[model samples]
Target: MPRFEELDVWKKAARLSADLYKSMAELKDFGFRDQITRAGLSIPSNIAEGYERATDKEIANFLNYAKGSAGELRTQIYIGMDIGYIEHETGKCWLIQAEEISKMLHGLIKSVRSRTS
Candidate 1:
């Protein structure tokens, strides 16, 4: 496996996570800040962790967790938008990024599974 830092998807996800954190910090008053913030942080964190995993199955599990976190981020983005804690454009942008990350994770997992099978 290539280094975790060499993966484009991982790099993108890391950047997305950092951006999300910056955006979230501006909205500290959001009622569920801690939960949503953790979810956002988890997306890229899991991606990097999974990429560093020694086994294919382990990587797959972590990727699945990252995918789940992407879903959580999407929901949180919507909630943030609905409550006016975040702008629609900002939320939509992050949602798009989350969707992309999900696709990349799904593809990575499929590739790994096929190779192992």
Candidate 2:
């Protein structure tokens, strides 16, 4: 299997992480800064970490963690928007990206699990 860095989903997630970081940086005083940014960072980092492990079960487990992080980021984004720290449209875009990344991670995990089984 190609390295996790070589995986398209991982690449996209990384790019999304960068984008999210840039977005959050503008809202430095946002109430959920630490939690939201960390969750966003964790999603792709976990994917890469799990992929580097190179074991199907390990990768799947990491992917699940990535998905969970995505969910956490999404919720935090909503909170930021609700509290007026983030623009509604900007928060929506981030939420959508998180959802997309989560689904992609889930699909990758399912594929890995099936191949191993």
Give the alpha-carbon lDDT of every model. 0.83, 0.84
| Candidate 1 lDDT (Cα, 0 to 1) | 0.83
Assess every candidate by TM-score. Answer: 0.91, 0.91
Residue lDDT tens for model 1, 13-106: 7888788777777665756777777887897788789878888888889889988998998898898899887789988888898899889889
Global fold similarity of model 1 (TM-score): 0.91
Please list the residue runs of candidate 1 whose C-alpha ends up more than 4 Å from where it truly belongs after superposition. Answer: none
In the order shown, the candidates' Cα RMSDs to the true structure are 1.4, 1.5
lDDT (Cα, tens digit) per residue for candidate 2, span 1-117 = 888888877887788778777877866575567677788889889988888885789989999999999888888888889989879988888888888888888899889999989
Worst 10 residues of 1 by lDDT: 26-35
Report residue 107 deviation for candidate 1 (angstroms): 0.5
